[model samples]
Structures are given as C-alpha cells and as structure tokens.
Target chain A: MILGLTIAIVVVALAAGALNLVLGLLGKAPNDLSLGALALVELALIAQVVTAIVAPLVGNPPSGNPIEFWAYLIAAVVIPVLAVFWALGERNRWGTVVLGIAALAIAVMVWRMQIIWTVQLA
Target chain B: MRVRASGDPLPLHYSVSVPEARSSLATGLGRVLVIVYAILALAATGRSVSQILSRFDEAPVAFTLSALAAVVYIVATIALVAKGPVWNRVAWIAIGFELVGVLVIGAISLLAPQLLGLPDINPFGRYATVWSDFGAGYLCIPLVLPVLGLLWLRSRRDAARQAATVDAEVRA
Candidate 1:
C-alpha cells in the first residue's frame, strides 16, 4: 500500500467518523451527507483492496502475515456495508453513530494494514 | 404488513407491528450497542483465529481464552439482534460471561503472565488476547464493552418484556 493512499484513507475515515459522531450526538437523523461520507470511506477501502492485491503482484508483498493483512482488508470492506444496512434499518441518530463507529474502525484498520504491509514483525 | 407508531421511526422493511418496532431491543441506543458488539465479535474472532492457527502452542491458555471471548461476543451480537425472551436471556448470559471473563483474564494476565505463557509468543504486548490486562491492548474497550452491553440490556428490559408479551399473545 502506498503511504499517500494509506494516509488519505486514515484522514478521510477519521473525518467521516467525526462528522457522523457529532451529528448523531446532536440527535440528527441519518441523511445523505452523513451517509455519503461513509460512502467515500467505503470507496477508499475498496481502493485499498485493489492496492493490496496489485501491490503484492507488483513485488510488494507484505512484510507481516499475508493472512492477517487480508483479514483486516476484508473486514474493513464489510464493516461499512454492514453499517449502512444497519442505519437503513434504524434510520435514526443512533444509526448515524454506528456509521461513525464503523468509519473509525476502518481508519484504525487501515493504519494497521499499513504497518502489516511495511513493518517487519518480529 | 406494517404498522407505525407516532414517534417510532422503524425501518420500511420490518413486517412487525408498531409496538414491536417501537419497543425493540435494537431501538435507540440498542442499535449502537449491537454495532459495537458486532465489531467486537469480528475483532475477537480474527484475533483468536489468527493466534490459534499460527501459534497456539506458545500461549495455549491465552489463545483459548481469546477464542472463548470470540464465541461470547458472537453469541451476544446475535442475541442483541434477535427479539423475544430466549434471546434476551442469551444476551444476558453472554454479556455476563464476557464481564466475568474479562475481569478474570485481565487480573490473571496482569498478576501472573506466565500462567498463559505470555513471554514466549508475545512480540510487543504483555499478554496474548483482547481481554489481556483488562483489554489494555485494545485500549480497554474489551473491559468496557460488557458493562455497556449490560447497561443497554437493563435499559431495554421493560421494552423487551413488553415485546415478548406481545409475541406470546400473537402466538396464543
């Protein structure tokens, strides 16, 4: 994974998480803006999936466990979709909070992926 | 096949009555709790699976605890999502077990790390699982989640009871 892309994912995810968390706390319902930010996070995570696959093929296999890296990537991809389905069900402020939590989790996972990709585990 | 209460903003998909939706376990903060449980389940499952598959021999006790915690999280997540009394009881049991498990594991990890043989396989953290040292590895979320789950359960109990009564009547 490229450092730039990793940082970009982290920044966008955190921003999305913060946006949703504040809105949820304010008791705002789920709207396009809040959901769109999550959409963006999901898109970037999909990009990460592509990068993880292509980077490995292009001679950048992960320094850590491949299974671990892919496991985080797969989960990262699923979390947003799951949250979206969940928010669609609840259709309330708390659902927005779920979105926030999922985005935050993605951000954390992306950072871990970066480490797994680059840093050698002892 | 739908009913809507005045203040209850239920999903368009559920076929249940307004009362069920209004007083559901997944209403309000329960939704948030369910998501947290789901995430924790995922994390715990992943951690335990990886630990067990890759190096279970080094820290068998700790890895087994991780796997057990994973099972509890998965069960609690399902219980939170499901409706009715049986699921309610399951949720209480699972979350209650989680609370005890974390405290016990945390205490053991901190006091007697060698009981789980932590020193051998650990590369960085003091212990081998999510419940280690009261979830210190994951910023203590593991320690806190069960408490939150229990509180959420308490808050939802009456609603859950009412919902169960409605279900019973419908069945009868």
Candidate 2:
C-alpha cells in the first residue's frame, strides 16, 4: 500500500473507533454521523484494496507473504459492511459498542498489514 | 399452551407468560457478543487452515489448537444466535469448554513450551496457541470472552425465573 494512503486509513479507523466508543459509553446508539464516518472508512479500505492489487503492476508490490496480505485485504474489505449491518439491526448503546469494536479491529488489521508489508522490505 | 396451577383441576386462563424466557440470546448485548465471536471464528479458522496447509509438519500442536479454538468460536457464535433449550445447552458447553481450553493452553504455552515442543516449530520463538500468553496477539479478548458469556447466561436465566414468578403472581 502507498505510505500516505496507509497512514490515512489508520487515522480514520482509529478516530472512528474513538468516537464510537465515546458514544457507547454515553449510552447512545449509533446515529447518522457515526455510520457515515464508518462508510468513509469502508471507502478508504476499498481504495486500499484496489491499490494493493494494482501496486504490483505499478512496481510497488508488497514484499510480504502474499497469501497473508490478500487475506488481510479481503478481511479489511468485509468487516465494516458486516459491522454496519449488525449495528443497523441494533438500536442501543451496545450497537455503537459493536461498531467501536469493528473500527478498532480495522485499525489493528491496518497496522498489521503495514508491518507485514514493511518487514519483508527491510 | 395450557398452564395448570398446582391442585387446580382447571387450567389457568392465563398462558405461561414468561416474557423474559421468550427473549432470544441474540438480543441487545448478546448481539455484540455474537459479532465478536463470529469474527474470531473466522480469524482462527483462516489462520489455522493456512498454517496447516502450508506448514503442518512445522507446528502440528499449535496449529491443531488453533483449529480447535476456531471450532469452539463457531459453535459459540451459532448457539448464541439460535433459539430454544437445545441451543442454550450448546452455548453453555461451548463457552465452558472455551474457558477451560484458554486457561490450560495459556498456562502450558507460557510455563512449559518444551512440553509441546513449541520452540522447534513456532516462528514466534515462543509457545503460541490462540490463547497463548493470555491471547497477547488478539488483545486478551479470548481470555475475557468466556467469562462474559457465562455471566450473560446467568443473567438471562435469572431474568427468565423472575418473569416466571411475576407471571405466576398475576395468575394467582
């Protein structure tokens, strides 16, 4: 992944996680704003997926274990959609908590992807 | 269904009105738990399959444990979402086994790596299972999840009982 794009994804995911966590702790359900933020994160992940696939042709291929990299990329693309669907059915503080957890997981996965990519290069 | 009070020839006009008993395990907080367990199930299954297929001979013990953890998570996720007494029993069994599995594996991996020949095949240079070192790789959620599951089960049971009592009083 491009370094700048990777950083942007991590920042957005972590910020979404923090915001959702605060809302959950306040006994609030996920509202439009929070869900919209998650949508943006999902869009970024989609972009990352495209970048990951194209980078190889463009001479910036990931040096990591290819299978693992692909697996993480697929998971990153899928988790947010699942979270949003699950959250939509739930209308309580716990619903927001679920989103928070999903956001945090995305952040962690992104960080791991970065490590997997960079370590092989090093 | 018909509800008969003790020593009453006539069935109680009121149904067995246990409102809480009708509540499924996947409501409210339980829904969140289901999502988390489902994610773990996917993660563990993928990791173990990849490990076993690519390098089974390298770390058979660790990879087998990972596979077992994946099964437990899958069962737990299903049971949490399924209805009826059968699913309730399944949830209890799955969650109970998970608690024991994590504790035993965590202890063994941390204190007795040689017992499992972990150092020879583990790429991480330490004994590692899904619960190794208290699930250090996954932020210790494995360590905490079973405990939370059991507690939630207990609370649901309590609520069912309480609702039953209330229904009985209303009938009386």
Candidate 3:
C-alpha cells in the first residue's frame, strides 16, 4: 500500500515538475497545470502522513530510523505550505518554479519515506 | 558603510542576488539550484544530527564533514535568499567554497573509498559523507551545486555590470 502511494506521489510530482520546467523556461504566466500538480503532490503527502500516523497506531510501525522517519514527515508537511506561500509571492514563471521546487522536494521525501519503510520490511 | 542584518561574518561568500532579468539560458536552472540547496541543507543537517546522536564514535572525520556541509548549505541558502550587495558578496564566497569542497572532497572519497569504509567501525561510519561514494547518496548535488552556483554568480554579475553601465549613461 505504501509503495503504491509512494509511486503515485513520484509520478504526480514528476509530471508537475516537468510541466513547470517547460513553463518556467518559456517565461509564461503561472498556470493551473502547475498548481494542479502541486495540489496532487499535497494530497499524496497528506495520505502518506495519515499512513505514517496510522501505522504506529495499528502496532505495525516502521522499523527504520525513527529520526529519519519523523524528519521526512515534518518536511512533507512543511514543504507544501511553504511552497504555497512562495508561489503566491511571485506571479510570473517564478511562481511555477516555486511549485516545481516544492513538488520535487515532496518527491524526494516520498522516496526517502519508502526507503525507511522498506528497510523495516527487510 | 552599509548595515547588514546581525549574523556572524559568514566564513565565505554564501549570498547572491537574483539577476535583473531571468535569461532564457538560466531561468529553470537557477531555480533548480535554489531547490537543490534547500534540500541539501535539510538532508545534511538531518544526517549530521542523527549520526552524532546515534553513533559518534565511528568516522568522526566524515560525520564532522557532514555537519560542516550542513553549515555551508544553510549559509548558502541564506546567502541565496538575502538580496543586495552584501549578500551578493557572501553568496559568491559561499558558492566558491562549495565548489571547491565538492571537488576536493569528492576526489578524496572517490579515490580513497577506504576512508569511508566501515561496518562496525561506527554506527554511521559504515555509511559515508555526501562526498563519499562520489556523492551517490544525495544524487551528487554536491558536485553539481558549485557549477550551477558559479553560473548563477556570473549571471548576476553580468546583470550588475549592465545596470551600472545604464545608470552611468543616464547620469551623463
């Protein structure tokens, strides 16, 4: 379940990031596609957070580095919020750039989380 | 003399300014540098702290380097975000060091993998610094950042020069 969600996060993030990369290069106005990509990443992150919370509750907690796990969790939550602020601060290609950065960060964290959980499974 | 916000003198140039106009050559790329730097700051700090707490005995040198990398990343990020002349200087120095550090350390780690080798050597000693294994861990941003940073600095410098020339012509 976690693996599937993690893959979903990466796919959505990469799609958004690639689109943002294109728009950012063209110097186009920030568009909803970028925003939608970011929103999808956020939704996937929220789901990951819920899974992380419930895994421990269910007594099947991840057995990897707890510090790493928590760090990933905190970063996942904070990145999107900070991104929204940064995106809103600029209306040009910069806004899309911000969204791209945030989404990329989310993807990395998701990958890290997967590594942590997989280590536990191993 | 211009006033700077209170912070210890950064050991190097760690701040830079955004160019007056985003060039077609560097628009997405510069933003990529900023994003990568932010992630490095977070990752390096996290690894350093965790290493220190979990196992400080093994690879003291590498872990310390990790911590230092974290500091540099934080400094670079601040320098990148802070605008103006002071920050531009700071960013230049910081990015310069970053490039040097990555190249030097990357070479050492790559040619001398033994330096990072250890199983029970220490808790995290079994692992390596960001420079270890040729930066295989963090996708080699350590190698890439300095190159990008240099480009970013040059772009900003060019913009500054252009602005100054325009100002001079207007005054004349």
Best by lDDT: 1
DockQ score, prediction 3: 0.27
Model 1 scores what on Cα lDDT?
A: 0.82
**Candidate 3 chain A lDDT trough over 10 residues, lowest sum:** A113-122
Candidate 1 lDDT tens digits, B1-172 = 1245789975664455435434447778888888888888887787778777777787788889989998999999998887755787888999999999999888877788888777733323423688887887666888899999898888677665687688879889
Residue pairs in candidate 2 whose N, alpha carbon or C atoms collide under 3 angstroms: none
The order by descending TM-score is: 2, 1, 3
Task: Return the lDDT, model 3, position B50.
Answer: 75
- What lDDT score belongs to each candidate, Candidate 1 first? 0.82, 0.78, 0.68
DockQ for candidate 1, please give it: 0.39
Compose the digit string of candidate 2's lDDT tens values, residues A15-91. 99999989988999889978987898899898888888898898987776556666667777788898898887768
Between prediction 1 and prediction 2, the one with superior DockQ is 1
Error of model 3, residue B15, in angstroms: 23
DockQ class, candidate 2: acceptable
Q: Relative to the unseen true structure, what is the C-alpha lDDT of residue B159 in candidate 1, on a scale of 0 to 100?
A: 61
Tell me how much of the true interface, by contacts, candidate 2 captures: 0.26
User: Mind listing the fnat for each candidate?
Assistant: 0.47, 0.26, 0.19
Model 1 chain B worst lDDT run, 10 consecutive residues: B119-128
Ranking by lDDT: 1, 2, 3
